[model samples]
Target: MPASAAKSTIALIGVPLELGAGAAGTVMGPAALRTAGLRAAIAGLGHHVVDEGDMDVPHAVPEFAPGELANCRNLSDVAAWTGEIHDRALSLLASGALPIFMGGDHSIAMGTISAVSRFCAEAGRRLVVLWLDAHADFNTPATSPSGNMHGMSVAFLCGEPSLTPVLGERAFPALAAGDIHLFGVRSVDAEERRTLVERGVDCVDMRMIDEFGMSALLRGILDGLDPETTHLHVSFDVDFLDPELAPGTGTTVPGGATYREAHLVMEMLHDSGLVRSLDIVELNPFLDDRGKSARVAVDLVGSLFGRSIVHRPSPRA
Candidate 1:
């Protein structure tokens, strides 16, 4: 039997912290998404959308003294932002609203996923993560060539060592490796790949997507999800799309998921009805061409919330 198609109350929480990424300007992502009409797109799908506005990190982000953690930058600011995001995310879940966390960078997922994991634990639901990005993002602080904290989010959420402080006082349970599925990955560091293999994380890289096609690969993954018991969180990085399509990300990799492929993934997930939360990350409007990437993102979100081309009305002359 197919899952019920019902309108959902979606809480959009904007986090504008860019301290975790390798560059400035990602802090403008939330605003870009909003400007691109993300709210109206979701509402068009018959969902109730609540704009929670933007959240700020503590005014005085702690200063991590020298040698606190080698090869990691902006530790204090990132930690403060993550902690705040975690707390607010929990509150939104408790309010019975599915969260759409609009990010400043991928690093915010550490807190967002942690909050969702805790909610799933308390609700007796299985937590699953679908990571849609160009990079694997499995680099630990020690393994990262660049000290950007965004690259380390997957490791932190999967219980890797040396970055636990990002969660601050929160003690959310780490998601198991098998519960994470990395899709559309085309860029990965050498050690990051090793870590993913060792942890038994499922990865369907672009090469695999080319071989098996997105429909077959995505369906295989979604087929295993129990809609009644599983809470699926999609962590979508804009870099997952080809730079030609979405050039607003700091980390743009060539040969990513095509426009149609991305929408198909969203539509299939919507049909499965397992998605509970979402993180739209790595959108750097500072590098965008007239909000092109932002508009693309909003369109994808519309598909995820149940938009269909077949239902379109005739255009007025």
Candidate 2:
């Protein structure tokens, strides 16, 4: 634990549905995070922390027509989780507590982001998503090499036609392409790369981080926001950290953010006071080395909620 900051209610909702990923262990992610003391870390920062225990696996709805999206694996199960999460997320947002969605996999964003998008629209605010991940996650079904639904979450949230039905009659206000900023990206599928450029999505790849540094690049993103009218949702994928530091996730990629570099990003986001919601995804504990990854993730979340080594004046002040 570090120093405490302002008091706020922080709700932890665990989504344990991992049918969207290409691996078996992400379903254990939520429990790993809890065991790593995620709730206590935030509470140590003077926030009122509520632990809404892991959500039960939703009953798969028989909503998809046969062969509608044949390429996507576990399509119906993913759709069920998406719809259930969207409803739960919307209710949490309405309660006014900052929600940290502890995920089973990255695919849960299809629901969480959709809820945030709707909430922002109703409040007349712009929703800007800072997607911190190793992969862009912008692939459509046609473009995905592995057919894993987790790979297509960003595309689905942006209203890719084929995935719209995943929400199944839920109100979805598609996020604008410009509102999304993908950071820490290093591995992008070929067609996913093309789609990202064509859609004009803002991406700060690892090469850019290496060239410009995290502070300068992140400041460019933070400087453009209007704190009064924007809701910042941070979707943090564990693979964004270098594999050497956090080797828990199944989708480990080389040359990711170092420990201090990741902390700087979180510290900066905390100072901005613009983060309204967050997702910590893709921690597959079975792949971890003696719970190392979960502890790192909890520490990062602590920084995001205003834990620091020394008292620093608020940049907003």
Best by lDDT: 2
Q: Residue 96 in model 1: shift from native, Å?
A: 0.5
Residue 6 in candidate 1 has what lDDT? 64
CA error at residue 68 for candidate 1, angstroms: 7.1
User: For residues 237-304, what per-residue lDDT tens digits would candidate 1 score against the true structure?
Assistant: 99999999999999999999889999988887787878889999999999999999999999999988
Task: List model 2 lDDT by residue over 42-158, tens digit each.
Answer: 898889999888788886675577654778899988988898999999999999888999988999999999999999999998899999999999988888899999999999988
lDDT per model, in order? 0.88, 0.90
Report the Cα lDDT for residue 235, model 2: 99
Question: Which one is best on TM-score?
Answer: 2
Clashes by residue pair, model 2: none
**Candidate 2 deviant stretches above 4 angstroms:** 1-5
